[model samples]
Target: MAIAEALLAASPQSACTAMIDFSGRVSKNPKLDIRAPGKLSLSHLLGWQGYRMLALLLSDVLALKMAWQIAAHFNQFYSPLPPELNWGSWLRLPSLFWLFAAATLLFFAYGGLYSSATQWKNYLRAGKLVSMVYLLSLVMGYFYDPKLDPPRSLFFTAWFGSVVLVIGFRLLTTLILRQFEQSQSPIPVFLIAPGDRLATLSHLLEQQLNFKGQSASHYQVVGAALATTAHTPTTVQTILASKAKEVLVENLPDTALASALYWQLRRHGITLRLLPSSVDMLHRRGLPEIFAGLPTLRVEPRFLSSLEYGLKRSIDVFGALVGVILLSPLFVAVAIASRLSSPGPIFFRQERMGLHGKVFHMWKFRTMVTEAEALQAQLEACNEIKGGVMFKIRHDPRITRFGRFLRSTSIDELPQLFNVLLGQMSLVGPRPLPLRDVERFDTWHHIRHQVLPGITGLWQVSGRSDIADFGDAVRLDLYYIDNWSLNLDLDILVETCRIVLFGKGAY
Candidate 1:
């Protein structure tokens, strides 16, 4: 655990240098000063660090072998090309394909698609890079041989399949490696919180870090750190003495003890992590730097780059188009039912906060009566949820007969396909809140607006209307923002289907 923390503390480039330095000393030279800070060159090329280098090499070799095998299979299955065509005429393709594959692999690596830094970042980059490689391969095929060019259909199949296969291969490797590491050298984590808060933090970490609800074999709570100064020093001393790798302080109040304990842990080479707390650590200043070049604190925000944003928008457009086409029958049925059930419009367009806190008219099929808003004030005292956010009663009297059905099945949200097509929402992202909700938000809540709102999101699939507390909702939203990715989005979409079909956690 200490080794992992030390490695994590080092920059990616430094970590690569350290690995190279260690490797060189053991294999080639003995007197190299690999430990000297900032001495190593090739920092940019450090993406080829440690086992990732081996993974890339293996991926290239496998891609080449697969390409050749595919070419052989194609030659066997398809009629022979004109007499002018020969094996030699297409030999350049496999070579060029391998070269492009290697370049794409490196591109993905450099983009942090292969790093532990962020999960969603990795997934997004993988999709875009793989897609780009597919397009490039198609263009390369066109240039290679116009007369004996492979069928466009075959090219598309091979290109998409190859990208999928390559990405799957890498993902499998990563999963296997992670599982092995978890089994062999479980992370040594220490929990520091008031005794009352210990169980909650412990359960959360165990569930997240150690799958299967098993107690984390890698993590151990040395002791609890009180928010009060009277016991803070004693807790810190006890924790340091235990030699725990990482100290996680939970539910710490914004107070002097919190600041003192943080600096104390720093002095002893112990990494401090704060759990989900009401106090805004973002406002704290004067953080003490332990390492020479490292920042004392790190804050990660959730937002994709311009390229990733564009790619995501492209996906949304394509998905929304296909979805609307396929579900046109359902859409028509819902619209007719809604009109028959209620005298209001088929669709509900309400002002919701979107990306960057911009106001947009979010679309949904109306699942309430035309005068639903007018009745909100009268029903305020009957609210079931504790949060300041507005939530309707499970047996709301204002809901039309068809509206109840729509709410239960979540079919009312289907019209958001139009919003997605119009670039107002994504197929999967943080749920867009109303402008009134945004006005009530604190600083941390603002993070949700960093990305475009989604038709279905973490909150919807995780619990939907069942999640009554605003704090839980915010945490889930923050978790999604912190860990967004194409794979995660796909997972949420699948889960959303299950939730909708089963009517789980629906109003």
Candidate 2:
């Protein structure tokens, strides 16, 4: 295509001599029709995406040089190049290092590292890519230079350092780019789905917001067209008036209608994307293929391996220790307040369902009378939040005067750091439930207990005690588990702090 385009662009007649279909068959296109489906204007095609790959390649090479210098600093045989001198040293990397640089970039590209539009934001995947590149480099080195005259330590340190530096560079660059991007207007989008599913689809799209719901002052939903086409003229007018750049069609509509709509919408140059037929099962990544002219998606395995669990536990331990130390003063203050204001033990320990329904003593700073649990049955009839496995009562009689304050402030949850440190919980996971609540849970409800519980979770941060529907809470937990990553944990932690500090939805 590039060759054809160049030939046409250079021709005196300014006409194309041939058109190549996807089948590799050459045909006449004397009319210079370049609007083929798989082709685009060269400038637009080579825009930011090509530049992004080049930038990543440069970053990887720089990371390689930095890794080598840092590794060499620790090796007894090599003299480390100082910072000012390293500028020229990077350009003079050993001939073998040049080979390594090319291989690293190619390996990363092969590993899907260079493909992410927001590479820095996808740190976990990028980290895995870095490890792959490093491992590949090690294997290459072993075969190509077995003796490793520069020292094996050099390669090892460089491997670790490349991961750190490459990620760090991407992280900082992503932040800057994200800030710049937010200033630009979002492309208008038209949603074509069953009216009943509009609300759910809206919420899903808004999750792509910078800050879900709140900071989303501007909405990308420019218009809506019902799949049923109840009012065809209205839908067409809305689409035309809104000038939507994209149309999202739900899988509910028949292919004939989707095809008709696509033909009508494509005339306006609106990109069309069909919503997955099975949104639930496609929550994680999948292998996309074509089967007999129809798109096919195969779901990937959802289980976490032992190594992932071990890494998750290690992070939980470290985060818990840091949190406990940082909040020791608040913990002591809450403990003292609980004893003085509630006339109960400083800590409240109750048997709660942990992983796989294993009972564990979940600890919290007492935020109720000593006999609050005993009074729970009496107040059952008056429970304000209904139709949920968990029970809650507005203006409960059992909450002590200070207990109310403690609960509202979420200080009651401070002691859970100990549970996290003890390995009975994680810093971010499904919140553990009391045995009474567990007893009321259905079989499907037991799924939340598959992972260690936490003090703060998707439910707590999303709506906290305000969420009355047990099924809704369970769904959020499952979604978290299915898509678990370090970025998600950080997001939840930040959101939890915001909710706790604002006293939103707390009793």
Candidate 3:
């Protein structure tokens, strides 16, 4: 790529500079035309993210006050003290309470509670930080006065209350602020991808803007360029000219192309979202280590976070059970509509590859005619997926009028909650492939089957049926497995809900 070579030319010590020819090609020569943008000042940092952080900080302060009052109330009831020593009865809080609250705020700030980059919805993180602050305080107290008899009731109550209240208030704060964020300006974004992906990525971003509206931070694609030009002087100039605050990269080649582009954009305070392909993604999962005094990238096959995985499974079962109960009425309505729309059973059960290639019957509300399976052979030519591995069409003959509605809204997949309940699926993982699609998969594609299938996944929320290439979809699935976290799962679930609600990409 031209960008890789441009990096060396753009270096401060290099005699040969970079130049962009009229043909849109980067050439190594004297005097590069690229102008490095100035570093962002502290004033520029206070955007929407800054305002959100301030709001969260205000919530934390209020939560700490409430927790202190609650702890004091319970402590007084349990163990009354003499009037002179009863500081809880004072007009202002005891000096100890103020000191502890100040320490708690400092700990929270250090824990990234007020950072915009931290997951705002991660209530667990806030609770953990609160607990840590209290634990540290207790340890310090023990060392300070070993013989002093501290009020156990007040100390324990304050610690527990702080944790619970902080998390509760943070959740409330996030919900309230979300309503006000809609009026904010859309984030200007530049797009970078291979020629084939340029249109696809643009359409996906446009779809998100149209469907979700302003419920989320909307992005406007102010500029686009070939991924090959990513780190080139011309690309930098174009991005700067467009005044894009963020750049979304798709399938960028694995090389210095990324490093150079990152540094180039970082200097200008632009965020780079590199949604790399499978090979680069696999490289990302490796942990840097030293073997025999030589640096190496160690890729472990098994995840060491057993406790988190257990928590994930617990959430899956609980969420699935609750979903089934809550959506039973919608299920009944869809089943009735399906029966009246087509001459077929209300449910469709098809064999799908699950974890470790275990075959299971995946359930869905029937959205096609009874003869849909037999008719597949005739419709193969109409498959819209880039590779023949997966079958998809923008419009199919087998779908009944009502079936279209079901498929678009993803109501057809509601029955998969039962699969999740049976441990055949997760609420968030890779989408299981039909036996027909799996049969045509390349060797590497089977890696996705290493985890339980899900009713909704990265693939569903990223682009759904709009994604034409089976390989791109598989890359997203692999990315999910390699970087799985509770916060990531929550992010996917939230995006899935928004996409499904708007019926943006599904056929």
Candidate 4:
């Protein structure tokens, strides 16, 4: 992560210095001789990201004032307070408020809230984060002056006002920037990937650009090189003629066209993107995952991913909270129905594997009759979804009529939101499987279990209910884990809603 920061920080001239002897090849590509105005430099790319961060940071500072100004105005309407009751100290940014603002900025920076790299920073997320920072400030201020006894009302007012202002500012800024981007030409990009996958990959990347706002309008892939083969002088010439300043490398072997060739281009101010086969797999980016130097991707896979992943964690916490709260009435109704409809338990707790093979008793609203486990062996002939190794049966007799409704409508999975809260699961990830299914797994299949299991995953969202092979299911799960991102999670969640409302649901 630190190395990645350094690469982004590297000066344009120094970082773009081509140590490798690319001069011979450059001569062959005469277009490379002419440095066009449209051609981007390293500093230009860095400037975009750096300035975006600055804009966000400035917005946060402005929001702090908006919050204080609201609090200050509210104080005017109230009766004159005695010295101790006065909550006006929060408005004094020179002393205690200074510390609060500094701490809040630090928290934002650490959380990647200030990063322009994040395209998913919407109002709800920004508001939630702002509320937390102010709440923390309330706690710290208590310690700062134990005798002052700050009014709880003032803290709450400040917290609420800050959330509204910050989110409003951010939303306005994003809309304006998005419009500016939509009006501009896209950044020229050169793509390199396997021929078989190129068209599909290209389409997905184009879609992802829409998500990237300004960056999306900025990226325009002008040419492509074969991933399976090394780049020759002719291929290099074709790339130069396209006037591309960004290179997207996917499925390209490092030995062939990736390492030296891509690295040289990067040094010459062409940005390098070590893309996954599926562009959606970009969610797998839990770190400062881009590399100005291609070799940096090899290091820091463990810790580098965690902080960015915390962004995903925040989504999980918020989604689970909303899901559980909104569904409480439904939860009760299902509990009553399950009990009256021949269920032994309102909620089912069965041991299942999770991240790194750790076992957790996963929770689900019971959707099968009493001792359904004992009756499974008798229903072998009715198995529907699984080819083998895992068990599933469409319209199984073990499920009561009410339970069947729960399964089909996916109401049964709502209780697992509690599991998501307990940190045993994510809102979207590989599906956790039963012990019997895990016992039958092949070696390569275990990789799916590396991430926290999800309530609905690629399998559920893809509407692959007719899949007879467990291996095929595992493949989807693995794909989700590998490409997992907060945006991807939200996409699956939206699709899960569509699938459930439309009649398809995970077994």
| TM-scores, one per candidate | 0.50, 0.49, 0.48, 0.46
Candidate rank order under TM-score: 1, 2, 3, 4
**Which residue segments of model 1 deviate by more than 4 Å?**
1-311
lDDT of 3 by residue, 91-117 (tens): 666566666777877766645466424
What lDDT does model 4 reach?
0.61
Candidate 4 per-residue C-alpha lDDT over 219-249 given as tens digits, one digit per residue, 9 for 90 to 100: 5557765554323444556666677756666
> Residue 301 in candidate 1 has what lDDT?
19
User: RMSD (Cα, Å) of candidate 3?
Assistant: 18.8
Angstrom error of the Cα, residue 350, model 2: value is 0.4
Q: List the residue pairs that clash in candidate 4.
A: 16-267, 187-218, 187-219, 283-484, 283-485, 387-468
Error of 4 at 389 (Å): 2.3
lDDT of 1 by residue, 299-415 (tens): 221111223444666778998999899999999989887777779899888998776556779888888788888888798788877666756477889888888888888888888
How well does candidate 1 match the true structure in TM-score terms?
0.50
RMSD versus native structure for model 4: 15.9
What is candidate 3's TM-score against the reference? 0.48
Which 10 consecutive positions of candidate 1 have the poorest summed lDDT?
Answer: 30-39
**Best candidate, lDDT-wise?**
3
